[model samples]
Target: MSTPEEVAPDADAVTRFDDLGISGPVLAAVRDLGYETPSPIQLATIPTLLGGRDVVGMAQTGTGKTAAFALPILERLDIAQKTPQALVLAPTRELALQVSEAFESYSARMKGVHLLPVYGGQGYGQQLSALRRGVHVVVGTPGRIMDHLAKGTLDLSELKYLVLDEADEMLKMGFAEDVEQILAQTPEDKQVALFSATMPAPIRRLAQQYLRDPEEIAIASKTTTNTNITQRYLVVSYAQKIDALTRILEVEIFDGMIVFVRTRNETETVAEKLRARGYSAAAISGDVTQVQRERTVSQLKAGKLDILVATDVAARGLDVERITHVVNFDIPTDTESYVHRIGRTGRAGRTGDAISFITPRERYLLKHIEKATRQTPTQMQLPSTEDVNVTRLARFDDAITAALEETARIEAFRDIVAHYVRNHNVPEGDVAAALAVVAQGETPLLLNPDDDPLAKAVEADGRPRRDAKERAERGPRTERRGRGDYAPYRIEVGRRHRVEPRQIVGALANEGGLGRDDFGAITIRPDFSIVELPVNLDAVVLDKLQGTRISGRLIEIKPDRGRAPRREDRGSSYDRPRRGDDRPGSDKPRKPRHKR
Candidate 1:
């Protein structure tokens, strides 16, 4: 195995499929699929890969990396044989299906070619049967592939080419060990190609170990800022973020929008909330069916849907040119993720917009994002009551103008208004006022100021104060707590695993059979966070709380130290928001954590 030096770009590499050296059948498939010139990565890697050489290509997502490897892999396939010869491993099930579809599209002219995508959360009987029946290509995740290999259901003994798609993502998802174990089963002489957006240390080591003197191709990242994309953020409370998002949706002129949330639960919740507010929004998460995910994305691309709320993992390889806005409903956890999220828009030289919602406490994360992007995100002020009213009236006016311009028959309505004046003997001004009221009623003009809670709250805080009246009777508290007695426990996880105080508090309150009030003073220092719980609580509760998750890590909740550190007593320490330091806001207050 040897490493090939960087090769100069083939003159025709950037050309359209017809002009490129791709065969007649491949050209026909490309034409039918309606794709034009090759993307940067595709231009650089396709030829090398087609020549039966191993490849290590580094390119960002949505840069047509799929075709970079797929086109070449399909070109080398023997149409007569239906045996599994090539295997592709993707990080997620969504991408596995996509890669399989790409194989089908690229090999449309090949007779007796079969490609199967096998992944978890899907039927195994069908996959086993497909493998037995004969498939030219197999795409799957690492874990499922390992399972198939162990079951003797997938045959890699005759495998000639292996592709690790999105290698970096697989590592991040804790699939590094599974990937290495699966790779050990492939034939020693097989051609290996690895592609990733970012080359972390582990991936670099893997490539060095696996690839035989492979050709290295690195497509330079698009470094120039997309001036066409107007990036901005709105500082709003967590409770008011949905309202803030609704206001922007209502007022902004967008062709299509993708709203990203952190969790799968939030994707559904946010989508449902938008639907209740009358927005044509859909949700896409890992739990959704393949058909549902396809339908949701297809609808958005076809102009039938206006907004899609999706998680980062679920929205991979999503390329829709009509998407005009990308909303970070929840700030992305890292800089690279933020880049990918915003890259969905401002395509084809069309101007786009990305707006993020940052809470006061999370403002520091926003600053980090700005630094990563090398551009400050403009702060978006809440829409004032006057602004909302003005926009509402303008919409009404636009409707009237549209009706007058487009309607062929307005004489009847005009005559009716004139007739009303004559019959009622009312002044012309009064009749016009009545007509305006009726016209406004028929329009889709939602002018309630409080509909935007953030705006309303800001406005309320600005005005004269009003005293609130206490309820006649106190409502029942959710949980009762003991004042003095407190129990303590410790978890195995520490700062290395990224555990935080709130995560521990939430985990304990929800899983430990401890009510909100049952938790006493909480202290989170370096390594671990200590929480005070009711002493002598049920042994069953203690047993359950032990082995509970603090921050995605099982903890051993036991006893705490006698002397607890007070919150105000401790000097201000480093606080990193969940969004990481790469979000918005200024980094004025950040300091590196001090080591003991």
Candidate 2:
């Protein structure tokens, strides 16, 4: 085994993709995607892969590794030879689909180049037909690819290039055996490329067993978090997240922003809430089509959209120069994900801001993230009602100043004002004040701290407002748990399928557009799991969940008529309190009034 070579990211050395021997149609496609320079991984891996040598790339998810392999494959592709020549294996269906889309984007100018993405949940008929018709490249998950190979429907005998993307993730997901089996079926002399964020023992062994004297390229920085970003965290309850987020939006000055959530359904839920509050916002998730995702990104770049609520997979490889802020609406499960989420901003040496919401139970995750990144995020205090009022007043003053500059438009209004003053025998100042009131509309112009629900929810110390007696009685609310109003539902995935509670929640929330509060107890059993969902769910939402997949198994959800399983029989249960539940000190749920 040889040591991997460290590659310094010199954005100034090779300013453009054309400088790296990528020319003609491929370079044109790259320019069309608004990429002007190659990333560190691309700068090191492209020429090596193009030179026909096996390469092992060590880089993080947001480091442009997809293009590092995709561009070279496209450049060396034999379009006329439609048989599978390149096989790229990803760990999940979402990544496989995203890689497939990247291939399509890079090969836009090439004629007669066909690519197919084979993954679970999708119908096999389409994949089988595409494979039979012939394709230049195939990107798929390890399990589905192995299934195809066993069925004799996928032929890798003619394969020339193979890429194992996120290999460590595949291993962790229990696909090591399947991956090895698939690798064994490929040609002995074919070129191989393995990419992983971290090289564990299993990954190193797999690379050594397959790759032949591979050229090692490692792209890493001294600190994972960028110095150009000012990172901050707010301690807020799940129920208070929306209020804190909206308050931040009101006070923070940002050009463009992305709010990241853990589940796809949360993306739509958050984005819709932002829009209803008069922000130009949109949602992007795996459920969204590639075309719509592209359009939304374009709108963000073009200044038509101000905020985007996106899931991790959906925002992969998203590069926008205008993004000034990244908000982790829900804390990521892993430290690497946290790094990647904040990496969306503070790019190209521009200063950016990253804010995260952390609950008491998730404080340990934050500590892990800070330890991994080697930088502690500053604690942020939510903007006070007076702070927001001050900002509003400043903007109102600026609006009046700008209007004053438009002499031509103001002339007409000036004459009307004077005529009213003369006819009603009113002073000019009083007339002006009345006009200002009319212009401000029905919504109040300033926030009253005493009456504001958001102000009443939190105190100066950022803790939930509580009376002295109640505070002593309840102590500190550490963890919130309850079984809300929900009815039992059964889905055909369980311990047998190695499915987890989070996976089930993600799949259902994404497909059904349900918020986290809509979910209740999730009890995983041997063959099937019993989940509690909102009662009287729409028939359409149920149909959507029936086709959704978790661990490559269809949910096949239906009403669970059986009695609730015994507590001992339940493998796991997620009994978190609903978002709208009353807080410890509050008599009722707090709903903040929005003036925007």
Candidate 2: where is the Cα deviation over 4 Å? Answer: 1-3, 10-23, 30-40, 60-64, 81-84, 91-101, 115-135, 138-158, 173-178, 181-189, 220-229, 232-248, 254-489, 492-545, 549-553, 563-596
Give stretches of model 1 more than 4 Å off: 1-21, 34-36, 125-129, 198-201, 223-226, 231-251, 254-351, 354-596
How well is each residue in 61-88 modelled by candidate 2, as lDDT tens digits? 6567888999999998997786799999
The candidate scoring highest on lDDT is 2
**Least accurate 10 contiguous residues by lDDT in model 2:** 577-586
**What is candidate 1's lDDT per residue for 336-434, written digit by digit as tens?**
567778888997798899998765434545544665566788887776655767877787778778879755467667788788888989987898777
Q: How well does model 2 score by local distance difference test?
A: 0.78
- In order, candidate lDDTs are 0.69, 0.78
Q: Please give each candidate's TM-score.
A: 0.49, 0.54
